[model samples]
Target: MATKTKITIQDIAEKLNITASTVSRALNNNPRISEETRKAVLKAAKQLNYQPNNIAAALRNGKSHIIGVIVPTADRTFFASVVRGIEEIANKLNYKVIICQTYDSYEKEVQTIDALLSARVDGIIASIGKNTENFSHYKKVLASGLPLVLFDRTTDQLDVSQVGINDYLASYKIVEHLIKEGCTRIAHFTSPKKISIFRERLRGYTDALQDNGIPFDENLVISSNLQLEGGRQSMEKLFEAGELPDAIFSASDYGAMGAMQVLKERGVAIPDRVALAGFSNEPFTSFTDPPLTTVDQLSLTMGNITAELFFEQFKLKDKKFVPQRTVLMPEIIIRKSSLKKG
Candidate 1:
């Protein structure tokens, strides 16, 4: 069996009795080419099954027309929704997106950035991994002259475009709501303070307590990875103190769910014995026993805005650009987890 010869612009040109350059211009939709010639060239190219050399074209134009999107993990609904929002805009603009997950590992985040850079992507939009402490990898992106947009998880050390909710305000609102529910001695489950989101949430929690005349107790603040297991460990540690908190506010929904499981195992009544609230409003929050109260980070909107920011920067390439930070207002979703009925 003989393999078929790969069809090319030359073959299409030969079949249509037109110049190869004309065929190329037609395929590219160059305005200079007449519509009749462009249509005929396209029809012939399709009939011949011509495959254009995209790599060579990218080399000539100095653009891959591709963008990289980095997220900690896509398994969660929040990140997945954000990616959907990004793809909606990116696809319309004729740009392909490459999704990379770091799984909250600093080393993996660094390597992912390096890989994206090597791929020659036109730009990148990312949510910094929770474990990342160094901004050098992100700075390298700027030095290389590619646009970088950070969403949800961001750092101030690097001056680049960023889009996310006002985490401090969101935290304060939720904590205040818990307070209004008559929850005193509210405990907090948080992650490392190095990351801006966690840090801001912590600050909001502390400030809310002070404003409400509740004494700030260091013992009530538990620091951990904020994963499900971490939440369980943190709750167990609180139990060791021989005093139970009237309420629990977790920086992440996963952590809150973990704490909820531990409480249920101990026969503790939710919202009656101890109210609970969480952030990011992960989809499972609604389906949990006595649905949880959480903050809506507007993941899809954040993703759309992040992609738009990247495109804005891409268009202004080579221009002196000032970094733009977009902060969206977060909604506090009230549910049975935090509402105590008489």
Candidate 2:
């Protein structure tokens, strides 16, 4: 490869027939500098492809102008929308965003966090992995004195800013909706219990059943990964168990889709013989055969709020780590999938 030219302020200054300090002032848009000088320096800098070293600038002011974002998987529409929201604000603030996917692995989540720390990111926004039972990786972020905010999937054990929907209440409302549809036995297809969100949903499901005089049956609940295949397997097992639930409440839209496929394969009618509801109104949910009745977690708004929370913390300049929690109420989008009554 040919040697690439390294352009500096001095080179721009030489090209403009001005001092390096004058070039720096112009490039920084210093108020003392004339507008003509600023335009000329910008034109020269752009022509030379001069990239400012944020690392060197960070040494002076301790800001890398970079933000790290971690998500379970970008394949899901909800996470992609969340990332878009984060980038919307990040781009406006002139900060670069580095995205990392954990694939719901605890080890990968830790590795991603460490890598972001090594990159000297000014702040980090993450939704913890499903398998993340221990939050030591986040504790390290707290110890390092960096701005950290968790969204969607967060833990109360961690003293940090967070933004997420009320999963428990959302699940409760979904169960009640199913009950209103005349579903006596509501089967719950859930993710792992290690995560707080999943646990809360389960609590909501059982509580809703109990409050309505319906018994919480352990056999009706199946714990699975938040995947389509997992949902299918869970539905199959529920099938093999003999008695069918009048309605199914899935923790994820993907899982609900899989269950729907299984039920259809078995000649079971949706919202007729069996109704379906799911969490996180993913894009595919709306376009499903009968469309899915699901909860809108407001993922994009959650991301925006999380980013603003980080900015708030950064502005307050409080490094002591006070927990700031923001919870959003989830809305259920009633659709044909669960509208059994009408």
Candidate 3:
């Protein structure tokens, strides 16, 4: 077995017959060092397989070159797309991403954020969990001088950079579309309004009905956990009430799919007896028995934008980086489920 030799800055300097200070400056891309010297130093470092100690480098630069990303769940397609986007941008900029899944638990979320802070990440991008009621953990991250960006799920209490679609407008548009297609009594299936995204969507649903002169009935609005079982049970409850809605707008595609399955089992003709619409534009939407009408939230785009926002702050340390909240417009996809049979 051959022993591997440790290569360091001093070794590179000694081989090149240059001072360590010059090699260090060249490696750091200091303006004082000429471009030629910088290139030569990098080439030599590469040849020697020199691996700079990231911890030491971070200590010197006052940045860890790592961004912490906290999301509700990693198993979901929407969140996976967002992670892909963040990874793409982070890789291009020579930054690393540390992902933590909160599993929709408030305690886990707090613990995860604390762990990330202890790890000395330069910035954070988070889509909070369902049960997150306190903003104190987030406030600590802000207080630590770390740049934070919230995406998809966020709180109004935190004044930070946000990248997401307009949930309210998306919901309103879907409901309006259903109404235009002759759906009078529309039922809304959603999770608890504790999260801003759900609340916004619920508001949009109510506002659209009011604008179109349809009376808002509390019974017509069904609250679920935005899960498959929840959707299944909610649909059953609505049907048992004997006032089946002319249409249904679900906040989650899975929920919509669940409801659709039950309706199909009961021999209800879609878009004739009831039309169905959902949010998130998940891939399953296209393959559903009668493809689903859904709102495209551009999950990947939101993720990419969040990474870009982090790099923007990374490059320009002293630049006035104002907290920006960007809301993408959702696009409605017309499909067989919501298309009326003439």
TM-score of each: 0.88, 0.90, 0.84
Q: What lDDT would candidate 1 get against the real structure? A: 0.92
lDDT of 1 at 210: 95
lDDT of 2 at 204: 94
Query: lDDT of each prediction vs. the true structure?
Result: 0.92, 0.90, 0.89
Clashes of each: 0, 0, 0
Scored by lDDT, the top model is 1
Cα lDDT of model 1 by residue, 1-342, tens digit? 997678889898889888999999999999999999999998998888788775678667889889999999989999999999999899999999999999999999999999988878888899999888888999999999999999999989989999989999999998999998898799999996489999999999999999999999999999999989999999999999989999999999999999999999999999899999999889899999989999999988988998888888898988988889999999989999999764
Q: What is the C-alpha RMSD of each candidate to the true structure, in Å?
A: 2.9, 2.5, 4.2
lDDT for model 3: 0.89
CA-RMSD of model 3: 4.2
lDDT (C-alpha) at residue 341 in model 3: 53
Q: After superposition, how far is residue 279 of candidate 2 from its true place, in Å?
A: 0.8
Using lDDT as the measure, what is the rank order of every candidate, best first?
A: 1, 2, 3
Which of the two, 1 or 2, has more TM-score?
2
